[model samples]
Target: MKLFNIVSKTTLTLSLILFSQNVSQTHVYAGVENASPPAVGKTAKDFSLSNLNGKQIKLSGELKKGPVVLLVLRGYPGYQCPLCTRQVGQFITSAAKLKSANATVVMVYPGTAKDLNTRASEFTRNIKLPANFQFLLDPDYIFTNAYGLRWDAKNETAYPSTFVIGTDGKVKFAKISKTHGNRSNVKEVLKALSSSS
Candidate 1:
């Protein structure tokens, strides 16, 4: 009788352990139903991603300072996107103005999980980013899907998008560009930042 009791208790403990493991392993991303950008006035979803230097950057943490201008680039479609390069450069030129407006620019460089670090480093080899700007990598489109910005089309990685999230964590402006050359420009982003409360 004592042996039977011990065996039963052991089985119960094993079952509890398995259940806890499964519960804790709940997936972070379940993919998006549609590829629409988060609506204006909607509370932005919090996401954490690794930067070029392997440092984790969380969107909510950056919002603690002020507004955040999120740039989602078309990452590793085939070669480096010239349009993306130009867009990044344009924003970098106006970095000081953006800083004065109390805005944090968070650029998302997303691509496949294979050697993405190397690709991202190559993307920013020469251009210098200001202190208020952060370069984050979205490996395997994890962050993109989380924000509903994944452009899962042929020869495309992510939809070139821009969003302005206020300190209140509400999206003030959102733009998703389906084509390569029609991305949001720096003037519009700065304007959004200035208008954000």
Candidate 2:
């Protein structure tokens, strides 16, 4: 009877351990379900991330100068994302329009820690960033997670997102794209920048 009681207790303990492990795995897998996309009229969350030059750029600091157009990019997912490249090029083409409307453009490239700096520098190289534009690196996706843009699992970096922040430090417009191809265009962002009151 004593031996049977000891075995039964050990089994119960093992079952509890297994149950805990399952719960933990489930929690990790259940990534952002009901999170609504960030919207206009909300205060855009401020972040300070390092640039390729290792300089810290703050979102709030940019907003102090004028409105800001923020773009989040996927970085180094075993290959450069062509869709991100195209969207970035479009923004570059519209630089004048964004600046004319008193807006600073910032592109964030997020990647894993191993190659974040190298990849971010490579991504921005030779691109003519206007005086009002900056490229930021979200190493290990700290800022991405803060903004709820982290694509949980499958080795994904982050979901593409754009925010138009007003000089008043509030988000004037926001577009969060779930997939690769459905990002906000430069024209639409320009319109929002121009129409911001």
Can you give the TM-score per candidate against the true fold? Answer: 0.85, 0.79
Give the alpha carbon lDDT tens digit for every residue of 7-69 in model 1.
999999999999977776554333365534678999888889988878999999999998999
State each model's CA lDDT, in order.
Answer: 0.87, 0.83
- Among these predicted structures, which one has the highest lDDT? 1
Score candidate 2 by lDDT. Answer: 0.83
**Pairs in clash, predicted candidate 2:** none
> What's the TM for model 2?
0.79
Off by over 4 Å in 2: 1-37
Task: Tell me the lDDT of model 1 at 82.
Answer: 95
Candidate 1 has an lDDT of: 0.87
In candidate 1, which residue pairs get closer than 3 Å at backbone N, Cα or C atoms, i.e. clash?
none
RMSD of 1: 3.5
RMSD of each: 3.5, 6.9
